[model samples]
Target: MFIDAIGTQHNPATDARIISLVPSITELLFDMGLGGNLVGRTAFCVHPKEQVKQVKSIGGTKQVNLEKVKKLKATHLIVNIDENPKELVEELSKLIPHIVVTHPNKPADNIDLFSLIGNIFDRKGEAARLISELQAAQTQAQLSAMELDEKKVLYFIWKEPWMTIAPETYISQSLKIANMITYPQESDIRYPEIDLETGILDQVDAVLFSSEPFLFKSEHLKEFAQTYKVPADKLHIIDGEMTSWYGSRAIQGLRYLSDFAKGL
Candidate 1:
């Protein structure tokens, strides 16, 4: 028996039919050589493109098709705390035999998640290898961060409401590993909504625009340069997957952070 992030009990079975709503975990399953057992996945699980083509779509994370999931007879349903709403998880738990919910906030959290999933899928060796690789990458990222000068940055996710990553988010943790300090560190909210006129920009050395969730493009940077007093060179477009996803993708993310840190 194993407990998930939400303390849900699960009896790990070697022949469990899995349905993954978390894109990162979906990719992790494929990397673990369990892609054949993956009966269903969310449309967002685009990594391992060729493998995803064979997996059945279970709709989006929040709005999953319960009937379709039931038809597949999934023995394990994987979800994420940040991706799936509480009500949805609660509703699915009653129907699904094993609902594994994961919420990884940092590199250590990701390691634990990998171990848990490895145990669930009966692929301990593969999981260990992935964890080892991630640990090494994490160590390299931290080392590179120490060599770089401290840089204050504002990381933006959404544009319309002007959302930014707070200290509590995984992206903020990645930013710390990249030797970048996020502005307005006093916010209790994980992802806060604020405007540029709030004087937050004055404290930032740079602004990092994510290429996801809101799809911040090059044109937006030009518009921001015209509006704000910050240097145009300080604005950078970063891959959101490298900072946001917390699974096997984290190894690549940490590597990207290590390179970014050395350049700064």
Candidate 2:
């Protein structure tokens, strides 16, 4: 048996019919050799591209298609505290027997995540291997971070009105391991809209544009630089998944971060 992020009990199941709402966890399921057991996934669960194509899509994280979910007859449903809407999970719980809620707040949190999903799906051996690999990656990242100067960065996630993440988010913690501290160290909201004219850039050593949620391109740098005081050298586009995806990908992400910090 395993306890989920929400303290729900889940026993090991030989007959696990799983449906995942979180993309990272969905990818982790495949890595744990439980891809055959996954019957449904959200539309955003696109990693392991070819294999995930086999799993039927219920819908996106928030707007889940209950009708399609019913047809799949999934015994276990996976959700995330930040990604999946609470009401949606509550509604699905009436039909699905087990709801495994995940909330991986930092890079290291993936350790518990591996044990939680792996043990429940009877893939304890695979989970142990992943845990070992992730730990080794952490050690390597720390060594790399030691050689570089710690930087304060303002990471952009969206651009319509221009949004940035708070320090407490998973993305922030992931970057922190690379010795990149997210600015606005504190915020009233998790994701806050910022004004370019307000001079937040002055406080940050670098300004990063994430390549997801809102695809930040090189062109954005030239356009924004034309108006703002940001230096071209201080701005770079980062692979959003490496910082956001907390799963088997995190092992690779740690390596990516270590490499990314060395170039800085």
Candidate 3:
């Protein structure tokens, strides 16, 4: 039996009608050759686009469609602590037989994540292959990071309030692999709103804008440059999935971060 994030011991799932609420994990499931078992997924689970389209959509991560979930008759529900809400998961647990809770705090956490999902659904060989590939990518990322200078950076996830990720987040850990240290050094909040007037610009070497959740573009950089003395060249819009997403995508994320940092 494999243990989940919530300490739930799971027996090998057979003929499992799986529903994935976590987006990245949906992709991971497909990678582990369990596409035949997936009965439902959230709207945001868009990776392996052509493959996931065949799977039914329940709803968003937080606002799940309970009626549709029940109709799907999924035996296994895959969720994440950070991406999924507790109350919704609790409600779903009443209907679904197994609630496989996952919490991958860092990039390397994919090792256990891959193993958990694969072993439970009998995809051990595929999981081992992915882990080996991820290890090679990690080495490449390390080499790339060593070539670049370590930098303190401010990563913008939201615009109106100017929200940034905390040091303890997966995004911050991914950036750390690229030799990028996220500032504000706070841990209580995952994403904290920043006040530019507080002289926060003086603390960071560069600022990054994420593409997902918020579609940050060069226009925002131009607007910010008008207000702050920081050079426009130092501000960049990054691929949010490559930095924020975990699971199988994290392999590509690590490589992407390496290339992005090298360009800076």
Candidate 4:
């Protein structure tokens, strides 16, 4: 029996018909050599873009087509704490026998998730190798970060409401590995909504615009630069997946952050 991140108890199925709602986990599943085992995935689970076509799409992360999921006849389901809603998980619990929910707040958490998924899917060797590589990559990032000068950065996730990634977030922890410091100093809220009128630019060295959830283009950057009176050179568009997604993607993410840190 395996206890998921949400404390759900389940016995691993001999032939797990996995349905993945979390996009990152879908990518992780494919990376862990479990793509052949996937029965269904969300429309948004587009990573390993070519492989997604082979899997059936249920719906989005927040709202999945339960009827469609039922039709797929999945034995196991994969989800995330932040990406998936509780009620949806509860509803799916009745339909799917084994539901594994993962919440990775750091690189270590990701390794644990790999191990858990690997054991459940009987891919222990592959999971061990993945964890080792991720740990090695993270160590390299830490070493690289030691050499780089720390830059005070504000990472934006949403533009409409203007929210910044909080210090407690996984992305912020990942940024620390790259010698990038996120702002405001302390906030219990995960993604705090910001007020541009408050003049936050004075405290930040740079403004990082995310490419996911909210696509921040050059025009938005120009607008922000004008509003904050920040120079254009201090603005950059970051791949959100590299900064946020935790899974096999984090291996590539750490490498990207390392290079991103080097450039800074």
Count clashing residue pairs per candidate. Answer: 0, 0, 0, 0
**Tens-digit per-residue lDDT, 130-211, candidate 4:** 9999999999999888899999998899977889977878999999889899988688888889887776787888889999
Where does candidate 2 stray beyond 4 Å? none
Candidate 2 residue-wise lDDT at 27? 97
TM-score per candidate: 0.95, 0.97, 0.97, 0.96
Candidate 4 deviant stretches above 4 angstroms: none
Judged by whole-model lDDT over C-alpha atoms, candidate 2 comes out at: 0.91
**lDDT, candidate 2, 155-252, per-residue tens:** 99998799999999999999999999998888988889988777789988889999988999999988877778578998988999998999999999
Give the worst 10-residue stretch by lDDT in candidate 4: 6-15
Q: What are the per-residue Cα lDDT tens digits for candidate 3 across 47-77?
A: 8989999999989999888899889998999
lDDT for residue 143 in candidate 1, whole number 0-100 = 80
lDDT of each: 0.86, 0.91, 0.91, 0.87
Decoy 3 TM-score against native: 0.97
CA RMSD of each candidate after superposition: 1.4, 1.1, 1.1, 1.3
Give the CA lDDT, 0 to 100, for residue 112 in model 1: 84
Off by over 4 Å in 3: none
Residue 175 accuracy (lDDT) in model 4: 92
| Best-to-worst TM-score order | 2, 3, 4, 1
Which candidate, 2 or 4, would have the higher TM-score against the true structure?
2
User: Considering only N, C-alpha and C atoms within 3 Å, which residue pairs clash in candidate 4?
Assistant: none
Report the lDDT tens digits of candidate 1 across residue range 212-242. Answer: 7789999999999887767788888888889
